[model samples]
Target: MTRTARSRALGSRPARSRTARQHAVGLAALLLLVAAAPASASATPSPASSPARHLEGTLPSGAAYMIDTPDHWNGTVLLFSHGYRPEGSPNPAVNAPDEPTKQLLLKEGYALVGSSYATTGWSVEQAVPDQLAALDAFTKEVGAARRTLAWGQSLGGLITTTIAERYPGRIDGSLSMCGLVHGGVANWNSTLDATFALRTLLAPGAGDADVRLTGFKDAADAAASAKRLGETLGTAQNSADGRARIALAAALHAIPGWNDPRTPRPAPDDYPAQQANQYTAVRGLVAQPGFAWRAEAERRAGGNMSWNTGVDYSAMLARSSQYKEVKALYKSAGLSLRDDLRALARAPRVSAEPRAVRYMADHAAPSGRLDKPQLTIHTTGDALVPVRTESAYRQAVAEAGRSPLLRQAYTENAGHCTFSPGEQLAAVHTIDHRLTSGSWGDTSPSALNSRAQQADPTTEARYTTFRPGPYPRPFRGQGLFG
Candidate 1:
């Protein structure tokens, strides 16, 4: 999720459940592979007919790992990577996308494993190593499997791809769901555009020259920043002009106009409704790591990495899916859109430190140089890690001449990581098919939808054909400017 970083990505539960589940997946990884996660210690048990052995331990890296193996051994394994967990988050363990999927996987005899990274949010640098350590632990503790298949959600999704690209021999295939496939550098840089616009246009302390964006002093400082931005959103939502400006900020990052999975999608041409949804996306940023994760990445990278030194707001907006929404709202509010763009042009620009910029590319960016098959799935309306990120990855893969190895699918759902038990199983089966056949079978919506229905007839399957828009900012290929 780097934060669709998924509210469950395609489906989220209540706020409490979502956070708990997200953290749960991050906590488990070492040893023999499996696809069944039991969630927290107190979570309800899965009803697998085959008895399963559960194991938990801490790796040398201080990361926690968990595993569940069915009594009947399946030669193949499912190594799961989890989403982002804020530092100090409680309970690190494996959490399947949903409960039914866990039971189903175990019933079919797939072993599941995952690891909590060495650190929380933006811990991509440590994710792969931690997982591998967990794999070694699993091998020592449980024994080796004939084959391994990797799958992940949110930030873990990116880790899964990196595994496919950098260490393809370790696994046969990859499944990334609700992933920030564009990579962390691009993720933060584009987010900065929206944050910068919100700060300059609507922050209560807009005129204050000393407010900090990065280089957080501590968790308290990050919390304060989140609180301030949240207040800005709350106050801004009260006025038409304020809401219009909010659209400008959210659109800059291509935040989807559909905010809640619980609600039906807004009409395609309903500018006002879409703008309102964009407000939810912009506001949702405040609920993330309170910008502390940015600090985490900054520290690891050696300095500040995200910036807006030479961005052209007009050009940026023109590329956004919400361009018409912003124009319509601004015009309706009697605000001059060009003037606002000019104002952004004049605002103090943040510049990336060279060391950090280099770190961003080497550590955070994905080379897209794949040596194995990878399938990426996303919700079309995920605002957190917008669907456009898939577009960015598609470009990267094409550029790397590995486009044929990558297959991207989508669910017509609204929230991040919102797939059902059926949908998740369908994806797993799809990857398994490729591994067994040495080719990606038809990945079209019709084929996938039918597969999902067969996987879980009880759950609604909404897979569909889609092409996400271009990512607003890409740091991998672009040099300093991105």
Candidate 2:
């Protein structure tokens, strides 16, 4: 999905106690690092005069990493993991989200590091290990970090969370921004639901030209099929039935209808406007070739990893938070929800290859067993990674009995990872405070907004209270795709 669509699709804080021994260890480590550096090197410099130590190297696994440590070492290393890059796209070599944030962090004396995974295109398996390897490289090439924080955006957010859970002792804290924390099964199935609805509702008999849920031969073919479906949906949007169907599809996945941050969210009774926004999101889904990632994911997994077999549209909708909106839209259009449900029931269902499903679970799903402090940030208006991901993750963490270990924040923007330098700094500082104090500080939206404003006046103005709807069809491991 485009950043706009991702922002539109989806949409916390506290304090605690600290252990003296742990605090002493962390402090001692920091002091040791500072003492080891040349005394003169500890002096901060102006942005124009700052000299950062830069290092770049390739890991044995073929992943490349870059590390930047400012002249004034802060003893904290921000190990950034980047988001997904389509298989054929160029990979980024740096870890920072934006130049402004990068400079701000460096100017504040924080070290930054990141890795371009061994392979691209949803390679979460490679990313997790590659990122760890990059950190190892950092320790050898530079020096031991007094504290390390795993941070990432989008797919990288998943990687960051995984690292925290899998290797808690390796890092002190983690920050995940706009991550797909709901796991690959939930993410792909959500997309599948939307695409299947579009095909069943509008282009049912298009045959070979229709978008393929699986079995794509290549990226070009996947893109072409997505384009075809998008074009069909575009024309279909002119009618009430088409628009209602689009809303139904989006709701099944709990996709939000606020893609543009500049515009206010549609009011509860504004069915027409809501559907219009949903159509744009749906259009962006297929038009931007959002579904193309499914093909790439399947290719990497060696087969299909998603399915709709045994899925009951009625049951699914009943569980969806978007059900009310779907019902309202259908009623306004004088459409029969039962009839649409029947149509969905009659459509041929897709099934997943068992191995592929396992591959996704192993690489893309979080265990939700938080062993260290972790914080997540998402824009309430992000359509690409959807706020539903945060909701699903919260459920998982609660289920694991580790709710207190995790906290979440939201930006009032409408684009994917559309955080300003101030917002980014606020989140980083929040994590840093938690690590040092061993308890969360004030993490309320108002508190965070205040901090962000103080850090940068240009910060986006929408950091108000909001909660994301439930993620429709959260992954439950083994039997999820059956």
Worst lDDT run of 10 residues, candidate 1, spans 1-10
Residue-level lDDT for 226 in candidate 2 = 88
Model 2, position 307, has a per-residue lDDT of: 86
User: What global local distance difference test value does model 2 have?
Assistant: 0.81
What's the distance in Å from true for residue 377, model 1?
Answer: 0.1
Reference-based lDDT, each prediction: 0.79, 0.81
Task: Give RMSD (Å) of candidate 2 vs. truth.
Answer: 11.7
**Model 2: per-residue Cα lDDT over 63-121, one tens digit each:** 88888878787888899999888877887567798889998888888988888898878
Candidate 1: residue 309 Cα off by (Å): 1.7
Q: Estimate each model's TM-score.
A: 0.86, 0.85
Model 1 alpha-carbon drift over 4 Å, by segment = 1-51, 203-210
- lDDT score of residue 333 within candidate 1: 94
